[model samples]
Target chain A: MSEVTAPMAGKVIDVKVNVGDTVSEDDELIILEAMKMEMPLVAPTSGTVKEIKCKKGDSVGADDVLVVIE
Target chain B: MLDMVMTTGVVHLTVGNLIMWLIAFFFIYLAITKNYEPLLLVPIGFGILIVNLPLTYLMQEGEGLLWKFYHYGLEWEVIPPLIFLGLGALTDFGPMIANPKTLILGAGAQFGVYVAFFGALILGFKIPEACSIGIIGGADGPTTIFTTVHLAPHLLGATAVAAYSYMSLVPIIQPPIMRLLTTEKERKIKMRQLRPVSKKEKILFPLVTVMVICLIVPASAPLMAMFMLGNLFKECGVVKRLSDAASNELMNIVTILLGISVGATMSAEHFLKPEVILVFIMGLIAFAFSTAAGILLAKFMNLFFKEKINPLIGSAGVSAVPMAARVSQVVGSKADPKNYLLMHAMGPNVAGVIGTVVAAGVFIALAG
Candidate 1:
């Protein structure tokens, strides 16, 4: 399993995928809002979604694990 | 002995002086307690308090402390340009470079400036004074002061204060107008992310801007040249020290002198007039109109572009820097919490600075 980390400090504004969902590489997985801009975090590799460590309206720090896929 | 004691400054204080003190205290209160532009209003409030103290001579023509600061810094047109230098160093032009069309929105925001000019004229102000008063709509403090110094020196205090005050009020003033002009669907429109800007493009931007802007409006050279130069210092990667000094140390030093000198200009004799009230009223109108014009222009542009532009970001063209842009983010997010417009709004926000400088240059060329 591999964890996807947030690129910057911001609030998690949306979670686009659920645990156990199959995803393709570069498919948008989460939307992080920081510096007043929304950044879409994408899947790093195609895999079945394992877990989502964040939720909508969650404040996150840089490098925080947002999702885990296997 | 009795006459000598009676001649002290306390004996000369009038009701006018007391009223001016109250006004000064009000500004101080806002700065300290309400957290409204404390850096500017605190010094400005103290300057007003001291200047109105019967006969402190703080603003005496040739010798008073603030008079010297005002004459050398403002009258000689030094502080505003230096302030521009600092702003340039502090600014990030990458967003603007990534999206050039926002520059048009910046220029479009000046709609309020011209509107106010004619508005002031109809109210019976002379051309020069009207020009100074009208520029307050730009929501740029230094530009307002620069133009006022050139076009209408007497109106400097009222115009400068109006500009700064309205700038702080951007959050409060822009929301209603943004909501009024844009539909909820328009506010929720998500813009494509800005492309990453190259270092070469960043370095080239200031050079090209100075050449084009100065050639067209030579009167803008003082502020524009310094502005571009500061940006170059920041972008070049070779002049870190110069950039740091310009944006930090020098900027802070100039701000203190600028705030106090601007405040000293607002003595009761000059500030307590019916026309001064009119200037304030017109300034508010200018800000509202500028905000509306920007949003309208964005909606108009949406008709042509295949990729839609979020109209809410357009109100940021008022040039209050991050504050106006933040207002766009706040208002846009309210429509849809997931919509983020701050980075996109920054394009028009920075562009508004350039637009105001150009407008000021045109005014100087025409009136000065």
Candidate 2:
């Protein structure tokens, strides 16, 4: 499993994928908010969402884990 | 007879050139006293004064090194792109990635380029020159300089002054246009927070942006390549020191030299023509149109969503960076102090930079 990390410093605006949901490469995993813009965290490869790391409204730092993609 | 050789051909400065000196002084005063964009204006102002001193050896072959810098650097298009590299180091794509929708706002703002292009055309300016002059509306300094140096070399002085002047006056020029276009209720519309991007995404962003831009606008490769190189140095996280130097020291040095070099282009022989007045007028028109296009795009975006977005942020699509973003905040605050749109404005503001670059590519393809 590979960990999907926050790309930048921002608040979590939304979680698009849920744990156990199968996803394809480049599918958005969660929404990270920064600079008043929404950044989507996407899957690295086709995989199932194994674990959700952060909740909505949580402030995530650069490189902070958002989800585990397996 | 020996002294006559030295006295002869001591060229007298003309009234037109003297008038150029006065205008240059105005910018110098604005930069020093009013604290206008001193970084660019002060040196540029001085350059104008020094270069215009009739028969002065400042920019001439035997005058001084200033002319060499202008000829070898600006004329050759070496300096402006390097300046862009510094700007790229300073820019944070976070705002853009957070709200990729703002990319459209950036694109929308560039409608002014075409609008101004035709405006210049209607004013009896030819296509290539008009296209170069029209680009000043994009409000991107490097792009303006780049286009002028290539498409309309003679118009460089007027176009650069207009671009930087309007950029400094952004606080003044934009508010009235923004206010007249939107109702108070529309100004208060607040947007929701942007989503988070992944670390891998940040790492890949500069690379991807470069690839996309290069494939789409190969003419802008030099600009895009240098810009992305700086961004990569910044986002890579492993090169903080290099990023710091590039963003600060390197940029500062280049700006000083480039400002003076740009100012040197304002020789009266070229700048005092009747066409210069028209170029100045067209620059303002371009700026206004870009801002209007942003507001209109915001209204368009509002149609799709129930939660209204602040249309004022749309004007930040003019690519002046934090200045445009600050204009958004100022306008938002006057409506309601709690309505801080600075961050929200940044998304499109950054995108505006990209938008301007893309617009430059279009001109380079069509005009270059």
Candidate 3:
């Protein structure tokens, strides 16, 4: 399994994928709200989602695991 | 005696007062009907009406509340920098970092400022007055106010009005020049997608910018410092309250005071001058020249760049913020709707704001 970490400190506004969902590289995985703007965190590599570690309204810090894909 | 006291207003009326009243009404009409920057024009329109009323003491020397506000807010050079703080909170610099080279387009837009500077000088305005007039090209209202307050406070009203007026008309003034400068193929050129900016980079941007700019042109510190501070508040995420306050409440209050004070300065004696007309003319020229300059520079850069940039985005360097950037998108859409230039255009659009402030700082160092 590969980890997708939170890139910034923000509240996760949405989780676009569920466990076991297949994703392509650069596909938007979640929306993070910071600096009064919404930023979408995309997948770094193509993989099938093995676990969802973050959910909507979860406060996250940089490098915190958000999703695990395999 | 009672009738005479009541009739004093009629007795004091003059043609100048009537003309000013008509002008005030025109401003109000534009604000309400056309929505031409109503946040500024509405307050300015009402203030002009209030100040122009015959025999009113609202603009009286050292006694009028409006006069006091002008003295404290503008003359003291407080409002503009404070307004910058709010602007910082609203602005996002991600596009700029993602496309660092677009900063040159921002620098290119300042060509209009110098063009107007020399034009004003040739037309017989003193150096200080010329500097104030030239900044209208920057197309940022608060920067215009800050420069005018420092360099030529007397020209403040005309310059401020002209700046905001032209800014609202960016959709009109920019398109023709944009069309004139580039071919349809160049306009339709699609730029590569920008890489996403990292969060640590966003937080560090303000701190590093302040250090570099303040050290180079200390005159720009008050405005630049407050602007960067506001950005820090937003990026740090620890000071959400400060950022929220700066963007909403503080911005609203300062804008009200700034608009009214600016309008109050438009007394017939102060505003109805040959030079004021020249200032307005120079302002239009500044904007046109700036647009042309940005487009030309982009064309010139294409000679070297491997990946061609859509030249339409270059005109957004005039710093009208999202409006100038939007014009690029609209113009590009006419050529090819598939091209998405708004995000790309924003790189230069936001950079233009920084470029204008820096240009204003240079003038302050040399002239102020």
Cα TM-score per model: 0.88, 0.82, 0.84
Give model 1's share of reference contacts.
0.00
Tens digits of per-residue lDDT for model 3, A22-59 = 99977878887754346667677899999999889999
C-alpha-based local distance difference test score of model 3:
0.88
Candidate number with greatest DockQ: 1
Candidate that would win on TM-score: 1
Grade the docking of candidate 3. Answer: incorrect
Which stretches in model 1 have alpha-carbon errors above 4 Å? A1-70
> For each model in turn, which proportion of the native inter-chain contacts is also found?
0.00, 0.00, 0.00
How good is model 2 by TM-score?
A: 0.82
lDDT of 3 by residue, B63-168 (tens): 9899899989988889999999998988888888888889999989989999999999999999989999999998989999999999999999899999999999
For every candidate, what is the interface RMSD in angstroms?
A: 6.9, 12.6, 8.5
- Which CAPRI quality tier does the interface of model 1 achieve? incorrect
Give the TM-score ranking, best first: 1, 3, 2
Q: After superposition, how far is residue B253 of candidate 1 from its true place, in Å?
A: 0.3
The models' CA-based lDDT, in order, is 0.90, 0.84, 0.88
lDDT of 2 at B11: 48
User: Every model's DockQ, to 2 decimals?
Assistant: 0.11, 0.02, 0.05
**DockQ of the two-chain complex in candidate 3:** 0.05
lDDT of 2 by residue, B318-368 (tens): 999888887887787677643547777888898888888888888888888
In order, the B-chain TM-scores come to 0.99, 0.95, 0.98
